[model samples]
Target chain A: MAYEKPLPQPTAIDAPYWEYLRQHELRLPRCQECGHIFFPPNKVYCPSCLSDRLEWVKLSGRGKVWSWVVFHQRYFSSFANDIPYVVAFIELEEGPRLMSTLVDCDQGEIRCDMPVEVVYDDITPEFTIPKFRPIR
Target chain B: MAQMTLYDFKDKVCFVGVGDTNYGALYRTKDPRRNQYTLGVEAFKAALDDAGLNKDEIDGLILVRIPSYQLFADMVGLRYLRAANTFRGEGRMSALAVQYAAMLICSGLCSTVAVVYGNDGRSVGATYGGEGEGSSPYDVLYGMTSPGAAVAHMWRRYMHEYGAREEHLAAVATSNRRHAGLNPKAVFRDPLTLETYLTSRYIAAPLRLYDYCLINDGAVALILTGAERARDLRKPPVYLTATATCTDLTFFYTVDDFFRDGVRRCAEAVFGASGLTHKDIQVCQIYDNFTPTVIFGLEGASFCKYGEGFQFVQNGRISLGGELPVNTSGGHTSESYMQGFGLHAENIRQLRGEAGDRQVPNCQVAMYICPAPICAAHIMTRR
Candidate 1:
């Protein structure tokens, strides 16, 4: 069956971020001026200093769960089957946070500061979502 | 040259009249025909009646959620205005309306400005979530669609950080519902105990159904004028001594610091300008879009130390007749959610001592806090 979930359609600025994910690599934009790394990867300039000198750098894909929540309400019809799934804020070792779902972990055992690492969900051939799993 | 301090406009602009739709009566009146304009006009006329002023006296108009200023002004017959504007219906814009009206009045731009808000969200089926709604498309990408989910993430961390439990979150809802029992205008007056709150299914885990605000249709209007003009009005004037706003949009709709910096900055300016500390605040109409927001508001406003918010609400500390009664009108959780419009009205009522049954004894000072990403706070005093 074709993937039936919402996927991030890569724009011109963020196409590289998605392309990197396709190759099982996690990368983000780093400011050459301020050394500030940011997410959503659609920025044309550094958020901190507005410098146009930006470079995409590979990330370690290691982080900790800052916080997590279980969704009991199905806001999207596609997510209705996953009614009680966990979505968490994973604080990367590089000092920025990203939102993703936790996999291979029991809901009852998840802790706030639990160690986690990046895992990819290639739901479709074209798109890959970077999820997190507890680093047991 | 001397600096023009924030205190320069203190007590210069005052709220002379406050009015709202029969929220409880209109609860869940999902008639699409009941639009914002009809509700706005209803509240506007009621405010005019409360102030004993004619429609002709309203020269300036500020609208929220209600789309156009020209249409609202024309419908309400507000001609010869010095200032007229509109703002999106967000929690912060409610207090910003008061700040802008104060600016217009103190700068001699306009007199007797009417700030109005009318939301038919429930009527028009505003889910406030899901695809194509107010949330970012990135939010929907992960099935994290609503504001409640973000707050749930924060509360989960809060619980882990402070060793707080669901009972702490329950304290906020039950206490607000307890106050709602005395509020004839509140929407959810049915008895809600901690047990009910605990067992209620989570919309987003850690935050249950009762933790969220109701999506009801309602309208709120407040009449503002110069202090001199307010004195001649029928009702006692509730002086808007100070107002401030601090925004934290750096984190893409989520705040890593949980709105601590924004609330503190706004609180400092409001407290310094009004010359009233937390102890002097007899009543607080803190925005309760979600129960966690109340915790953040109290903590950020310096009512308690950071991370102590869960405990600060315990054992009737925020109930009526407690050290400081919060959301005496039941707030957005129990009372009808008018975004933040109803909260501003509740503050005026508390300062005017018109909040019967749920009135805090010897109420002299009341504060309104909206602790969103773009947080705002204002202090009102009885004159």
Candidate 2:
């Protein structure tokens, strides 16, 4: 039997992000005029300055763990077996934070402000999930 | 409009009736809608009965349903009435409901109004288990299956920003459970130790089973009438001193900043209207879907300084005998989690001196601060 992985359905606003993930990069929408970076990508105008000229920019995955929790209960059945996993919000060096799971460390060992690096988990043939690991 | 003062609640509208059903884990065997309908009807009737008013007297109705299922007009038969107005949404909807009801009465649009809420997670089947059929496309795609996960994100961020630990989180659960022990209405009304909280199975990372509120089958209702009418019917009518409502663009991914500062605007507006500070409030009925939310609301409501809420709980400041006793009726943690309606009912009970064992002694002023994804707040006082 072959393992089937879940794939996130992409929309116009977030399509570029998924495309960027295919090439192993994290991309966000940056306003060409105001130089503001936005996540979960949106339409043309910059949310800050309402500028229509926005460019996609890759982010530095280096950041500190802002906060985290270890899940002992599986909210989704697909994730049941992966009990006690750590879910964290990492504040990136590029001034934006993203929510992703933390890997490569024991759940109990995870702490706030711990330096971390992004590690991609190739869960499926077409998708590689962006996760974090402690930088020691 | 000069940001209408919060003091508009003075000698305006009052809550004459309040009621709630039992709170406990609702298993899959029960129908959630039935629980909501039955409890809602009962509470509605009880409020009407308590106010010495007939159902026909109600000209406006406000309903708050979780999982965004029930509409105010549909759930309680408000549409069938020849009533003047209706409104619907989550518990925070009450703030606007009360304000609208006040305006209706003040303007001779309508007189009596009823606000109701109900839910049954144990019997009706868990609506939060999987991708909801009609959720936002963003929520469905990103595995935002339940509030537990979304709030966990905020909790993780706060923990990382501050040097707060699991122990600090443990303190919140332990204190609420201890307070729940004294209230007969609470579902998990037994003393809980910090060790028990730390070891409890995690519902979401950073949130233990104890840190999350129980999804039980229950209903709560309140009757709002002009202050003049309320003064005549009930013993010690609980006046709505102030109310405010506010909303933020809803997208967890785009709106990464989850400090709940959006809700603070509602709190400040309401508190400003009431001319009261945190100290003037003898008891506070804050919505507690998760322990961290309560902590966030405490700071947002000016009960404590920002980012210092964890320290306040650490010092036993939010307990039963603390400087400002909060959620004396066990709150969502120990009592029933009826969206945010439970907090509203508890505030009425406290202000009227009807709170039995968990009463805050000689309570005069009470505040019900609701910080749902869409926020609403109200301050109540004894008449």
- For model 2, how does the per-residue alpha-carbon lDDT over B300-383 read when each residue is reduced to its tens digit? 777777778889887677887888887777878888777677777778888777888888888888887766666677788885
Which residue pairs does candidate 1 place in steric collision?
A: none
How is the predicted docking of candidate 2 categorized under the CAPRI scheme? acceptable
What TM-score, to 2 decimal places, does chain A of model 1 have? 0.97
Question: Which stretch of 10 consecutive residues in model 1 chain A shows the poorest summed lDDT?
Answer: A1-10
Top of the candidates by lDDT: 1
The value of fnat for model 1 is 0.85
- RMSD vs true structure, all candidates: 1.3, 3.5
Cα error, candidate 2, residue B278 (Å): 2.3
Chain A of model 2 scored by TM-score: 0.89
lDDT of 1 by residue, A1-136 (tens): 8767788878898999999999999999999999999977879999999999999899999999999999998788888899898888889999889889899989999999999999998978888889999998
Docking class of 1: high
